[model samples]
Target: MERFIEEELAIAKSVDLCAVAEYLGYTIRRVGKYYTIKEMDSIRIYSRSHWFRWSRQYEKGENGGSQIDFMRVFAGMEVKEAVFWLLDFAGYRRIEEPENRIVLKNQVVDKQEEKKTFILPVAAGSNTYLISYLNQERAISKVIIDYFIKKELIYEARGYHNIVFKGNDKAGITRFASMRGVFDKEGRAFKCDVAGNDKRYGFNDVNENSDVLVVFESAIDLMSYMDICADYESNKLALGMLSDAPLETFLTEHPQIVTLRFCLDNDEPGRKAAVELMEKYYQNGYEVEDCPPPVGYKDYNEWLKATKLLQRVPEEKAVMKSAHGMAK
Candidate 1:
């Protein structure tokens, strides 16, 4: 049991809360060491941390850990599922749930905590950096990117070149903010959420009248897939979870969700999470499919990169041929 505990704790420390938020579909904003959401005040996910783990503190109470505990407290997920989801979220390909998983009691919530308000970061002058990063480096379509900016779903934050992903409630109040640095260099990234946040709000494209729900781990992944499949469908909702915490809630709110598709990363944890969700929802009579990247690809972004490269190559060869024919 000690070994199990140690191992599980290690996995918890590895979960990325921001990624979890994006995967779970929560809106988070960061201002220094605090991350707050719109829906849940008193609770703030601590912003200062490495990629290996995250910490949370409640103004009215105390109950915190990394992504694992976030899922447990926020989503009421069991320890096994929480750990499994976190491990997968981290792309910890080797971490697997044991056949006979240990069941732990649920986290105790503090009822007396006062609600708090979430604030968005000061807005930037322009999305120059945001546009460049998503378009040139990430290769996303400008039209699609413009749509998000136009919809106010994302923007460039003031003071830094970080990108802001906003989460708004039904009343249209901005509740969650997740900011990510555009300066990552193949290592750890700079990101955080605003303090005093609520988990109820998310960066979603859910259609009340739609019957299909497409889930992804991050907004970039969701948008990348959107770039690949350019056709639009209003009856289909595309929701990206910063973590999987919001999966259950989104489904609950949308009883019309009959077809569930997971477009998570192609790693082991991503696949594991997809399978688990499929089995759980399949039993509930939902049509489910695991849609990872094409074989040998790590993610939609990678696939997009390769596809774009191939396309350019053909065009370049065509140009070369035309020049040669003209010379003849």
Candidate 2:
């Protein structure tokens, strides 16, 4: 048990206690009370609350603390237990003294420096970087592009440089896309590059006064839905959560939207965010609808691509509806 405390403390310090708690499905408070044994160095039995207090107290940088002081006060372990815990957590057989271990604490700092170069935040807002890669002539060859165009999922923009979709074509719609590239603060082009999670773009076209507004998980899915409703004319115009900040800003500054249909991502993050968004906006009269993708697919884009039924959508509205119903 003492060994467990040391190992757990090492992990807790390496990551945050909150993250560990989330992953382990156990609380720090409960773990402290159940697993702690005796401390070898301090001969003190530290309580859970006191350990947390010590963590907060010595948080920034403080030295000259004994090994027992750290384990008993900070880790909530007894002295005999702290020794074994440290040994087990550090993967060492034993420790003759506690103060020597203090000098080795800088290792985590080095690891932090290493991680800094690997991870980067995803870019938000407009992505015009794909412009250079756009081959208008070859775009027709891309099956996805052709599918949307044929179904009016996207309108042909002769001068926009790349294919652009309009949000005004439908009502109560949600949309999505796996767009790549980066954008500027003013919601305009910044650079052109290959697609990556490095950057992203999002937008919204829902009216606040509307009784129903649909939100899609990705821009591609939104476009697919738009193409599906191209003939209907009165169908919903979907927005993506990538557009959430913008939509919230718009709603806050102007009219408050009411009904909302959230076509959330089937993944964990999307589902969690959907719940949070629903909680945040539901009281404001914004009703959310869940448009889950078909079984075995995470979203509608995949559904459309896998099924290859977009080829059947004729340019005419009535014909498209008939085809869509039949395909479904």
Candidate 3:
């Protein structure tokens, strides 16, 4: 037993991670300096670079570790069991033979080390910048915006004056953050999902008195829903996932929620996610429904704009006439 364990340990220490994954039915969906394995949806393995350092495809969650950890996580096996199993596939494949492998793309490879890290920008003096942008420019209701700000869910970054929407854990620590530039934006269409955010801690506004939970794809949409429905149902809980990644986590965290309303975007991806999440929760014995953004509108924010009943986004830069400024 001791000799077997020692041998397995030695083999696991120098196993070919990519080959093992391929042999075990994990197809490489996206390959590059980082390889995205099918088995782990949001986990990227840094192949041909570091010894066994992999990073979570997710920015907020800690879903990363060494090759051994990869086996344990994806295979659902114990440490010793993984070590033993990996030994058999240690010499499974090699870095060459790209012609026959790493499908879906024909990009050439020059093996080099790369690392990803998440560092949240500094917060500005107060929520003044964000409040002005969302209320005056975006047309989101002041009452709804003020409510979230008071709850500490949204803020403004110091240098950029961007809007920072937080995904917080049970302990109230900011695990994930979604940032959109209110001014002085650089790239990605004025939006960025900062790394190191745990989707499990997706943005939530819970009202213990209410059993209905409405979910949205972005923070602006969430606030828009609240704005439109401000006449009633103020107690309904709202969750802004920043993306669909946190839908499961948010649902899981709120089992007491009897009604799950997916108020996602109206586009293909949004409808797809809403359908999936609705089915998943409905199967779990909860009442689930997907109410996508109204027809002729791409998102709730847009829908809100067309209504003109609520505080509407300014049609011109005449509104950016404030220190907070406007998107257009």
Give the RMSD in angstroms, all C-alphas superposed, for model 2: 22.3
**What are the per-residue Cα lDDT tens digits for candidate 3 across 1-328?**
2434343454455544555576678886656567776655555656421123245445332366655676776678877777666543332111233445546577777876554465776877788768877976667878888888888888888744668888765566777787775532111125556665555556667665567778877778878888877724522333444344565565566556788787888888788877887887788887887787778999988888777643334643445666346443
Error of 1 at 51 (Å): 27
Better of 1 and 3 by TM-score: 1
What do the candidate models score in CA lDDT, each in turn? 0.67, 0.41, 0.64
Question: What is the per-residue lDDT of model 2 for residues 1-328, given as tens digits with 9 covering 90 to 100?
Answer: 3444443443223322222122334333334443222322222222221222332445542221333345564457776675555333322233245544556544555343232231222322222322322222112124445444455434322211223443321241323222222111112221221222212223334444455556675555664454444423212433444346634543554344556666667778777877877777877676666666766777666665554445534446678788899999
TM-score for each of the candidates: 0.61, 0.35, 0.54
Report the candidate with higher TM-score, 1 versus 2.
1
The numbered model that scores best in TM-score is 1
Alpha-carbon RMSD of each model: 15.6, 22.3, 19.8
Where does model 3 exceed 4 Å of error?
A: 1-119, 184-188, 231-245, 309-328
The global Cα lDDT (0 to 1) of model 2 is: 0.41
The true-versus-predicted C-alpha distance at residue 47 of model 3, in Å, is 47
lDDT of 1 by residue, 183-244 (tens): 44333444566567666555666566668777777777777777888735532332344345
Which residue window of length 10 is worst by lDDT in model 3? 88-97
Task: Tell how far residue 2 is off in model 1, in angstroms.
Answer: 31
